[model samples]
Target: MQKLTIQWQRLLNDKNQTCPRCSETGETVNTGVLKLKNALAELGIEVELIQKAIDFSVFENNPLQSNSILINGKLLEDWIGGETGKSKCCDVCGDSECRTISFGENTFESIPENLIIKAGLLAAAELIEN
Candidate 1:
C-alpha cells in the first residue's frame, strides 16, 4: 500500500469532523501522529493508520472536557507532560511529576483519533463504491 500522508490542516477542515478531546477542533495534531509515528513505525505499520482511524464525539462546550487526542473513544492521557512527552507534567493533575522527587515520572498518554481505522476503511470503501 502506498504510504498515506495527510497534511494536518487539510484533514482538520472537514465539516464532518470534530475534536473529541477539546471539542473545539479535530485537527491533525490531535492524533499524535508525529509523536506516535516513531513508536508505531517500529511495528511496520504506517503512521498513516492514525489518520485512517479516527473517532469523533458530540460537540459540547465544556471546560472540563479535555482537548487532547482520543483513541477508541477514550481521551489520550499522558504520563509525560508537554507535547510528545518532553518537559511534561503529570498527565494526572497536570502536576510537575518530573521536578518533584515525590512525584513519579510521566507516562505515555493515548488520544483518540477523529476516525477509527476500521471506521475509516468503511467510510473510504463507501466513498469508493458510490
Candidate 2:
C-alpha cells in the first residue's frame, strides 16, 4: 500500500500546554487524519499522522514554526496553494506570533479540518501519480 503522512508541530509551554489556536488545530488534524485513513484505505494509501511538540527555546526563536502542518513532507499551504501568515497568539505562546493559513479571502488561526482533508487528498493524488 502507498502512504501519505501528515505532520503537525506546535509550541508547548512549560506547563505542556499549547496555545488555543494550536490546540484546536490539533483536534482538527486528528479528525482529518481519521477521515483520510478511511477515505484512502480503498485506494491502497495509508495515512499517518505525526504530532510534535516544539520546545520553548525553539518556538522563541521562530514562533512562526509553531502550529505548522506538513503533508507528505510538503507544507500544507504549499499543497493547497495557500499562504502562511502569523498573528498574535495567546498566553501559552507568550508574546510570539503564531502561524496562520490564508486561503484566498479566508484566514484561519486554527486550521479547519476541510483544509486538512483537501491537502491530504491532494497528497494522496500525488502519491498515486508517482
Among the numbered candidates, top TM-score falls to 2
For model 1, give the 10-residue run with minimal summed lDDT: 94-103
Reference-based lDDT, residue 64, model 1: 25
Off by over 4 Å in 1: 1-32, 48-61, 78-130
Residue 124, candidate 2: C-alpha displacement in angstroms: 0.3
Best of the candidates, lDDT: 2
lDDT score of model 2? 0.92
Q: How many residue pairs clash in each candidate?
A: 25, 0
lDDT (C-alpha) at residue 97 in model 2 = 83
- Per-residue CA lDDT of model 2 for 1-130, tens digit only, reads 8889899999887888888899899999999999999999999999989999999999999998899999989999999999999988788877888899999899999999999999999999988889
> Candidate 1 lDDT, tens digit per residue, 1-130?
2232332211121344433332323433544455445544554434453333222221122112333333333323322222333223333223321111111343323223433232333333333354
- My TM-score estimates for the predictions, one after another, are 0.26, 0.98
Please give the TM-score that candidate 2 achieves against the real structure.
Answer: 0.98
Off by over 4 Å in 2: none
Give Cα-based local distance difference scores for all models.
0.31, 0.92
